[model samples]
Target: MRNYLTLFLLLFTLQLSAQNHVFVETESFEDKGGWVIDQQSFVVMGSSYLMAHGMGRAVKDASTTIKFTKKGKYHIWVRTKDWAPFPKGPGKFQVSIDGNPLKQVFGESGSDEWKWYDAGEVDIKTETIKLSMKDLTGFNGRCDAILFTDVPKFTPPNKLEELSAFRKKLLNLPDSPVAAGHFDMVIVGGGVAGTCAAVSASRMGLRVALIQDRPVLGGNNSSEIRVHLMGDVDKNYYPKLGRIVREMDNGDPGNGNPDAKEYGDARKTSIVKAEKNISLFLNTYVYKVEKQNDIITAVVGRDIITNKETRFEGSFFADCTGDGTIGYLAGAEFRMGRESKAETGESLAADKADNFTLGTSNLWASLPRDTVTTFPETPWALQFSDEYHIDNTKADWEWETGFGNFNTITDAEKIRDHNLRAIYGNWSYLKNHKSQKYAKQELAWVAYIGGKRESRRIIGDHILNQMDIQEGKQYPDGSVTATWTIDLHFPDAKNSKYFEGQEFFAGTKHIKVAPYTIPYRCLYSKNIQNLFVAGRNISTTHVAFGSTRVMRTCGMMGEVVGFAAYLTTKYKTTPRGVYQDHLPELMSILKGETIEAQP
Candidate 1:
């Protein structure tokens, strides 16, 4: 009897394993149509998903092809979230199998945790079928993944590790990584500095790979984020360094989706594409790095649209990612927020070290219409007191938040969402309240991309402090000239009275200082050999960073690093080696001299 029971159990297990199951990643759909690929969340169901940001108008349907084997009753499950679980959410969506709509709808049903919702079983008759997600509300409805299974025992995995493994097996991912080709230098960021670095390096006859996480170049300056290019470029030191920036700048002010040319999005793309030696990979986000000892071997990036992974191998690498994402993954030491007065004897340093870095901004603008406009009441969103209500038509750099204990990188989704709620809530109050100031105004645009001011400071060979900027302390190896004053942003005291440690508006305080040059030593990782850095993440005390964090200064830094990277490839030397033994060689490049003719 025991032997018979064992045989029956073994057969049952095999049957379950052989049951038909189909897992479809919504973001991997061939024709995403009008849906936006939302990979911003570190806290997501899978790697990333698609969002229907129709803003109340139904977006075009996103559809994909699927093949089914066992033509029987198959249970359908979808992974999604109801953004506002407390009150009735605005977003709602439904899935259709083989042109047949599911009985139950999704998006408005689940909570913050992305769990599977049973969308009722369907009888399968054909081997091939079309699956699509139809949006009901023009609001931000999202879809992560869809699962269809014949076996009753099969359940979708919720744990990340288990889900990842399941996805790999189901998707038939290769055991080996995909090679994305070799390069002399790989600059990961695509912001002002990273873009300049790639251009400079490519122009100097070096093979370069420029990876940007967004669809367009210019991190904050891009129309998606809409921050204008600030600080002076080509004024001091290497005049040729800012040439690329000049070509790319469209000179349009204010932030919105008025037109593509306003932010020079097309112009930047054209310039980068024109470079013979530069391979521009837009919409690719780097998540991992492989290192041997202190040398970085390769970086791994995922295609935001296709959900494909690629390994980017390079002889030299640059951490131009504003958040120091690359450096952090490769185990590089970094600092966050203000330092203690005892650590650095700067007058601006706080008495105690605290995690209080500069805040991120979500700027919004309102367009005045001839006829009166009404905004939907967002009672579920954050509320403001009558006295503190800002009856304004636009929000700019000062409209910032995310100081306090919020981890900029990890808690990014929450921060951006808060800004969205704030924008909607503020507009609703303005239009509906007894105050008739904004009755004729309509929200033209609100940024989905949060423009961050500060984050991780990757430690380099030289840690520039407040005195370095204030005293104009010159380093023999200084390469990039930083002209901005010792400027710092803090939560507005008036705004803080309401939010307290979570103020969304910021106030700037500046002290004029003579322009000082930033040392090349501050542009490379201290321990991570062969890894260079630029932009806001470069080694600097919180006080010093205040002056050096502007986009143009970052561009100059990138230009310097790009030249140094060429030297590294030519001489086959590490970043430290270039600094100690070949300091003049780097200076020669900054001085706009030929590499071979340098003394």
Candidate 2:
């Protein structure tokens, strides 16, 4: 009986090993076609999903080929969401296997929360099968992942922890870190700021690693989020600071509302690739930071597509990540939202400290055509009162939300959903209403990636405030020059009356300030010795952030940080050491690169 039991146990283990579990991430498909990858939401079921955003019409089928070990009956589960579950949702799609459409269609009925919906069983006779998603309504149907398994009662894990383990097992990922080589400086986040920092540092003979969470290098400037470059560059004190920024500029003065051709997503990429000392890693999100007392030692980045983790070790680390992700993970001192009047003594400061930061935007643009286009009605959305009739077809920077006391980092997905719902609902009213103002308009594009303005600001040796810009205070260590107005955005009181807590429109109150210099002390962390920061996440008061948050201004800050980092490497010292002991050397480098901007 013991021998029989041992044989039975061995057979069961073999059966389990033989069972093939194939998981295909739709976003990983090489030929995405009309399906756009939605990655704005940080905490998602998996990395991200492919979204079919055909406005109102049905979209082209997103198809891929999957090879199986053997042909047999397979249990299929698709990860999808209804998006609007108040009633029968508009977003719907059907999965086709081996050119045969499944009996069960997905995206029409499911929880708004992402979950694995059983796509019913499919009988596969061939070793290879073609998988396709046919869109029924192009309102915004999405698919995160698809699973096919022959194991009995096999179900894809729904909980995040279980799903993570399942992914690791299925991908055969290494338990230990994969070495990504060593670098002098590792710059996280690849917006205008991070890109410039990488380029500048590489030019100065420092081995640099430029890591971006998204597939593209430009964060907000990329076509995914679509915000045009703002603020004046190559001016004020640091004339040549924006030379790298100019190389990647879209060139057109127009925002993302204009033709897609204007935004040079490829131009920025070419600039980075030309730098010999810079190693650029796109579609790699840094989730973990390894730190020694007061210093970050390494950061672990996971590949968005392959589910592989790589450890990047560097002498110096820059938190160019606009959200201050690395700093937060390293337990660096940081602040978010508004500050009390006593905190910074700015005229516009709040009476008390509160959680109110500039909102994020999921902007939309519309093209006018001679023929009429149809947009579906989204009655389930947060309705705008009849008093507010939105006749405009295009949504720009003003279309913002998430200001109502919420953590923009943790609640990113919810914020994005609110923006989407507002866009769809407002469009529905404009198109279906008796008014014919938008009769010939069609939405060309809408951003699924949220264009954020503010988040955690890492505390540094010096925190710039409204008084700094307003008084034009000059510092001995001043590096970058900011020339934009103190433009602060708040929830529009008029819109709030109609939508209540979920106001979408934001109004900007601008206070023009003279072009002022930002100090070197504002660039590096106070607590974390080797940490440096740039972009909007740099240490600054809320009112001061209004002026420095613009892209071009942030780009200049990056240029200075890049120079400072090079000095740190050359002198074998920390960021603060470069400022105190090597200020003259740093200033000499800045003086050599001085070239005036064109009038």
Candidate 3:
């Protein structure tokens, strides 16, 4: 009887200890090696994942050390997707435990949806073990998170809601967000417009918080995207409006320049750091908003790498995210597509209201090498023949996708993947089929970050239309002269012939227009009381957006918004109240006049 009691107690203790499991997020790895953290699909996928973007060659392995509570046999599961499901995906990789590679390969499954792939069972001999991801074919292989469980028949949740809850329970995240301090104004983007707004408001004696999701400052003009600044600055109604813009402009390096120095990422970062009143937060993505009645009180942002959430409280807020993400989260009225001529009464408006917006661009360039270089055949990529292929060494703005059929925000990942297919397939044809013609040229750079043009436009008190540009309409609150031609893009006829709905090339018609000052009424939300908007997401019809969406013009609009924020702080009023009550005070500031000495 004594031996039976002792055995029963030993069995109970072993059962309790066997319930140990460890969850590891790939983005939090100390050394990421060649894998890059991609947050573009986080809104849909629930979290950021690591992608191995090596064009076609295998990249360096990503390794990390994990400490386990109980050492024994455990089931390994990895969250990943095949990405391109045709026979099998090109993105193939393996997992290694303590330098021992697993037998089952990942990212070659039949389904394209993101799900957990069982990586078989392994015996963990020690409390601490080294785990690594080895890329077999580096065509954008990705991994979200890894799980090690000792419990039999244990599986992680697949649905987003359940997975989120499970992550919080396992990772021990706080229920309430950690406070990130209160500010006079909180700007939610780090593009040229948001940067200008932060600097301008900080100089005018207002505490500002500038939040950017990416590492760099310039949005499209950043080194990662490599788009040049367009439209004329300092040539507008208010000359002082674009002085900040001029300071950040790094002379046109063209659209798809391979040189990183030409875009000047460090230059923009230094400028924002110099301002004492501005607090800049980089690599932080805002996902939640707190509102009181009609005004936004605070926003909650999560660090992309650390997964730590921080709440930013502010008196006023700005929506400078190019996709109008902040305004959309606040339930602000917004439009996503073109307005019919019958509705807007503009000649350039579409005959029928439809879901047609400008497409996104993923640019690429090739450099001339001294010796002949070879590229592998991409059978999984979009196939092209000699009869229908873009016979070019480099791609520019013309290489675009997701025009009339696709949603720019929801279908962003698919659109980017389609562009990649087109790029690789076209280059393959040129290299293999027409090698004699282009033997010396090698693919130098291809932008994994897509340069987006149009998305949700937050409605303001005034919506600028094409007639405003054509007639040169001037308003009392007019500021920021837009000089770019009214440009709209459509699918290229030749490429559409081969790939109808998935056309990658774009064709545009540029209509000349006189420089016109955009109204300040178009920069603030009509319904959302304290929200100010700038960048490409400001209040503009699809027709007028063609002219007002340029970088320099968007920067000037930001400058005006900063000045308006100053007035809001001084008078203790909303954004709409500034235009209705204190128009003169706003104009005086735009004219470069100080308001009763700087605070």
Candidate 4:
């Protein structure tokens, strides 16, 4: 009998080794279920998925628990989506091993790729081994595939594999008794646009608060990506962008050669030190938008450090959330990608239907070549060419990947993974593995600050189309301005899937538009009355967005929305009312404090 029992236990142990006893697989709470839906995407491969929503997880909690006899080494790993690393996650949740809080195994503050976590085990003092969630402060997160297997039976870490980098996940924010009950205005995004909005509004005698996810000021320019700010400031002569610009690179950090790569990241401290009235919420994300009777009554902000969730109530709100999360939540109208050519009649428009991942570009530099560095080559993407009629060097501050082949949802992981793989592969060639331009080179900078080109666009009163941009159409209610040439990155830019029998692809181009006016109607929500949108997500046809998607115009859009909110409240009127009667007032706020309008 004893021999038979031993054999049975041995068989059970072998089965456990074969299966990891999968438990949870979901997205970071940062997405708030929007990314999982059609509005956004979480495209990845080789994993189970669940949609996380409503302060609850999508996956069923596990009823099965593993019982351990002796205390030994163990681990817990959470699968990740690809796009998480691009925008990174937000929200402060926790991981616990045997009821003990895991310091910072995972959180929504930063981005990570698919990997297992080394969750050191605890002593088995009780009858059963218990693993559970702890420090689950704030709200948002999903665990679709929750597995409880012996930690020793996990896969070895792959070098090329991308894992999320987070120091710690504080589950809540610091306690604050809600900053009064209301304010004149609340600005989201804290980048150049948000800062300008706050400074200008505050100077206009309005109480304002600027919320930002990063600890520093200047959104993309905040020492993160090291990209430069090129807009209607020095080029068009605006005091608002000029004052902020002088504080940053009085000369030109993004100009020159070696210096060009590090300009955006260097301007972080400059904007913060320059703006005073802007009560900056560094590292705080506006996760939820509360609406009461058609107006956004409060903007719910979560602080990952102190684990605090505060309701920032205001008479008005400006969405610079970048992804347009605030506007989407507030019932704003928005669209993503291009329509079929049959619908728009443009040659550049798509012919078929599919999810598009307007991917990010992570550029690299090898300075003062002396030593050789080896890298892997990407079998998929090809070298830059002119036949495709695209600028090979234009992808400087903003390098893009993953537009042609990858799906935007479920395959987002694959999209981001493929992008990173291609980038490193190309870098290897530059290093010594493969060579497109150099003989022998050195490594200068691997841009940690990734420029994410597209995701969500907020729907507004007017959806700007390709024709309007081409004609340089003007509106009586025009408030903000856009200046990038009508740039359209087609469905196939680098991948060969679009054009058959091709290994490389040159990017597509569209007719350019000189600087043009963007109407004020493009800021407020088409569905929700008081909700406003700023940033890349505003209503623009995929063709028109190619040009207006630039952050410069997005900032100006934020400024316009902020001022509009002020006037809307002052007169107790609709955005249209503020626009029609307040034309001179609106331009007075945005017009040539320095330079010329769009010709």
Once superposed on the true structure, which residue ranges of model 4 sit more than 4 Å away at CA?
A: 1-181, 234-269, 305-307, 340-348, 351-354, 369-398, 404-414, 434-440, 491-506, 591-599
> Which of 1 and 2 is ahead in lDDT?
2
Candidate 1 vs candidate 2: the TM-score winner is 1
Tell me the lDDT of candidate 4.
Answer: 0.52
What is the TM-score (0 to 1) of candidate 1? 0.92
Per-residue CA lDDT of candidate 1, range 1-599, in tens?
66765574566446547877788988888788778877776434447788887644578999999987668889888988887554656678888887788887777663766777877788888888899998887567788889898878567777675576566556767756689899999999999899999988887778999999889999888888888877777567665566766776778586554444678788788889998899999888898899898889999887777667789999999999999989999999999989999999999998999988887888878777888877677665667667877767788788887876577777776677667767767777787883467778777777777888899999999999988888888889988877888778988898888878657878988888777889989999999998899999999999899999988888888888888887887788988888888888778777777665212
Q: How accurate locally is residue 172 in candidate 3, as Cα lDDT from 0 to 100? A: 59
Candidate 3: regions farther than 4 A off = 1-18, 596-598
Model number with the top lDDT: 3
Can you write out model 3's per-residue Cα lDDT over 1-599, one digit (the tens) per residue?
A: 66764574456346445577788888888778888888877677667888888877788999999998778899999999988887677889899998899998899896788899898899999989999998888688889999998879878878775676566555657988889899999999899889888888888888999999888899889987888999997567776789999889989999888888899899999999999899999989998889987899999998888888889999999999899988999989999999999999999899999999999988888988999988888887899997888888888899999877788887888888888888988888899999887788888778888889999999999999999999999999988889999998889898888898888899989999998989999999888899999999999999999999999999998889989999999999988999999999899888877676246
Worst lDDT 10-window in candidate 2: 590-599
CA lDDT of every candidate: 0.81, 0.83, 0.88, 0.52
Model 2, span 1-599: residue lDDT tens: 66765574556446558888888888776667688776656454547678888866788889898888887888999988888766656678889986789998787784787889888888888888889988887878888889998888866777665576566666667888799988999999999999999988888888999999887877788877778888887575756578888888877545556465567778889999988899999988888899889889899988776667899999999999899999999998999989999977888999999989888898887888889988877876666546785667677788898784556877787787778888888887877773467778877877878889999999999999999999999999888888899999988888887877887889987899888999999999988999999999999998899999999888888888888888888878999999889998787777765422111
> RMSD (Cα, Å) of candidate 1?
4.4
- Candidate 1: where is the Cα deviation over 4 Å? 1-17, 42-46, 56-58, 98-100, 434-437, 596-599
Q: For all candidates, what are the clash counts?
A: 2, 0, 0, 42
Per-prediction TM-score, please?
0.92, 0.92, 0.96, 0.64
